[model samples]
Target: MAEQKNRFPLKRREFVKIAVSFLPAAFLLPATARAMALVRSPVRVNRLRPPGAVPEEIFAGKCIRCGRCVEVCPYRSIELLDIRAGVFAGTPIIRAEEIPCYLCMKCTQVCPTGTLQKISQEKTRMGLAVVNRHLCYTWQSMTICRTCFDVCPFKEKAITLDQLRPVIMEEYCVGCGICSHACPVTAADGMKAVTIEPIYSWE
Candidate 1:
C-alpha cells in the first residue's frame, strides 16, 4: 500500500516533465507559421506544371490567367490556381494523381497567352519520374513489376529494364504523369512507387 502511494507521485512527476518539454515547441509554432507565410511556399511538393510550360521565370510573366488551357484538356489534368497561390494565382497546375496528362498537347493550341508553349510531345519537359526503391517491388526483389515502364509514352527511350528491373532514363522522360497515374504500387499501398517531379529552374 505504501509503495503504491509512492508510484502515484512518480507518474505525476513524469507527466509534469512532458508537459514542460512542450513549452519550447509551443513557442516555436508561431514563428514557423510566419516563416512559411512569408515564403508563400507552393503546397505541392512535386507540383507538375502543365505540358509545354516554359521556364518558371518566363512562364510566370507570360501567363495571363486564360482558362483556355483548362477547358481544352481532355483528361482534366490542368487546373488553375486560386487566390491563395499569391503571384502565381491563375497559373495552371496538374496534380498527377487526380488526372495524368495524356500527352495530347491540345492545351497549348488554345492558350492566348504563351505560358504553355507550343512544343511537341517528344520535346515536352514537365518533370521527371523517380522510383522509390524502398517501396518498389523490383528493387526489393519481392516481385517483378513493370507498370511504370509499360505505360511510359517513351518506353524504350525513357524507361528500360536492367536485370529485369525498371530504370527511368531521366533524359528521355517527359514528366507527362502517365507513369505516376498508372503506378500499380499506389493502388495497393497508397504510396506511389513512381511519381512525377516538377521541373525546377534557376531564377
Candidate 2:
C-alpha cells in the first residue's frame, strides 16, 4: 500500500513533465501553422436555379461531392465553386462561354443524386441567364460583338438578336452561364454576359 502511494507521486510527476513538454508544441504549432483551419464554411446551393427552385431537394437528398457533372459536361460549362452558403462544401456552378445550356441535361445525367436528374434537354429549365445591358458592348451601343448570340447553342428561341445586339428571352434563357464565360469583356471589365438567378413563377 505504501509503495503504491509512493508511486502515485512519481506517476503524477511524470504526467506533469509530459504535459509540460507538450506546452511548447502547442505554442509553436500556432506560430508555424498555415492558414488552414477547420472553419464553419458556408454552403451555397440552388443559386443557379430560380429563387424557389430548390435543387437540394430535387437531387436524391444525399449528393456525394463528386466531379461527375463537371466531367460529363461537353461545353465545359459545369464547374465546382467553393461553398459559401449552406452545408455543402464544393458544388457545381455553370459558366456559359457564350455557349449556354442547349438543354443537354448531361450534368443531370452524370449526377448520382437526383440532384442532377436525367431530364430531357427540352424540358430542363435550370435557371434563367440574365444579361447586364450596361456591360454588354453591343447592348451599350458599342461595337457589334454578337459572340454570345453566335455561340448560343439554343436554336432560334434562347437568344435573339435585336438591333444588332443580343437580348435574352427570360422564358427561353437557361442559367447556363455560357455567355458569361464567352464574353470578351469578362476578364477586363469583370462583367459576365450571363448570370444565374432563381426561377420565378409569375403566376
Candidate 3:
C-alpha cells in the first residue's frame, strides 16, 4: 500500500495550478451573461412570429408563455420556442416552410397576454417575401410557373405577374408565407425561390 502511494508525486500541487488557470474564466462569466441578455437574437428567414405579434424588442418580456396561441391554431402553425432559444424560450414562432400560417386569425384571439393581438386576416403582417430570381424558373425563362402567384392568399394584390414572372408588391403583402410554401423551385440548400424575411410587423 505504501509503495503504491509513491507512484504519484506532487498531485496536490498540480491540481492547485490547474484550479488557478480557470479563475480568470470564472470572473468573466458574469460579464458574459450581461452581454447575452442585452443582445437580441438576429431575425432568421422563414422563422416568424404569429400575426399581430408585438415588436421583437419587447416581445420576450411581454409574452407569458401560456401556450394558448399554439392550442388554438387551426393549422397547428404556431410552435413555442425551446430552451435553446435563450431568453426567448417558450415564445411562439411559425416555421413558414414546414407549415405556413393560413391567416385564420384564430391565434390572435386566443392570446391572453396580447402577445398576439386580435386582428383581421387582411391586416396580418408576419414578414416580407423576397424572391431569389436566380432560382426561379419563370424568371430564368425556363418555364412559365405561376405557383407562387396562384397560392398567395391575397392573389394579385400581393403578387403580380410581369411578363409571366412573379413580382412581389411590398405594400400590399401581408407575408402569410403561402407563396414560399407553394414555390416549386427549390435550391440545393433547401431554400425555395421565395422565402419570408423579418419586416418588423409593427412597422
Candidate 4:
C-alpha cells in the first residue's frame, strides 16, 4: 500500500511534465493557422450561370445552392461558387476548360426552384462561344482541326465553316459551351482558344 501511494505522486508529476510540454504548441497553433490562411490564394469563379439560368442580378438572389444542379449535370461540369464569391457564393458555375455543359437539359429539370427554368435546348441561351482567332489552330492555318464545328450541337445554325474557318452565329448559338470545351488550345491563362462568354458582359 505504501509503494502504490509513492507511485501515484510520481505519475502525477509525469502528467504535469507532459502537459507543460504541450503549452508552447498550444500557444503557437492559432498563430500558425492564421499565417497559413493569410498565405493561401483566393478562389476565382466565373461570373456566369448555367443554361436556362436567370439573369445575373436575379440569379444571385434566387439560387438556393441546393447542389441539385451540380448533382444532375451529366458531364460533371457544374461547380458551386466558393464563399469568396461574396454575394454569389454557393451559386452554380461552369469552367469550360474543366468540363463544359453539354446541354443535356437534365439540370434544369431537377431544379426544385424555378431559378433554373426547364427550357428546351434551342432556347438555352447560357452564353455565347467566342473564338480568339489568334489562338485558333484553324484560323492560323496551322492544322485542319474542325473540333469546334464537329462538336457543336447546332452546327448548321450556330456554327459554320467558311474555308475551314468556323464562324459562331451569335443569334443561333445557345451558348451551351460544348465548342469551348472541345477546343484544343489551352492558353497560358488557363483559358481555351474558344471560350463561352456570358450573354451579357462589359464587352
> How much lDDT does each candidate structure score?
0.79, 0.57, 0.86, 0.78
Q: Write the per-residue lDDT of candidate 3 for residues 1-203, one digit (tens) a residue.
A: 66766986657789899899889889889878766854555347888999998888788889999999999998998898877677788889998888999998998888888878988887778899999999999999899999999999988889999988899999878888888999988899999999999776435
TM-score for each of the candidates: 0.76, 0.59, 0.80, 0.73
Against the correct fold, how does model 3 do in TM-score? 0.80
Which ten contiguous residues of candidate 2 have the minimum total lDDT? 37-46
User: Considering lDDT, where higher is better, how would the candidates rank from best to worst?
Assistant: 3, 1, 4, 2
Off by over 4 Å in 3: 1-39
Q: Which candidate number would show the highest TM-score if scored against the true structure?
A: 3
lDDT of 1 by residue, 1-203 (tens): 89997777667788889999999989999978766664453424347778778777666578888789999998888888887666677888888866888889999898887777799998888888888888888888989989888988899889899998888898898888788788777636465888777644322
CA RMSD of each candidate after superposition:
6.8, 11.5, 8.1, 12.4
Pairs of residues at least 3 apart in sequence or in different chains that clash in candidate 4 = none
Candidate 4 C-alpha lDDT tens digits along 20-138: 99999998999787666543322223234677887665776687889999998888888887765566668888876677778888888988888888889898777777889999989
- For candidate 4, the 10 contiguous residues with the lowest summed lDDT are 38-47
Q: What lDDT does model 2 reach?
A: 0.57
C-alpha-based local distance difference test score of model 1? 0.79
Better of 1 and 2 by TM-score: 1
Better of 2 and 4 by lDDT: 4
The stretch of ten residues in a row with the least summed lDDT in candidate 1 is 37-46
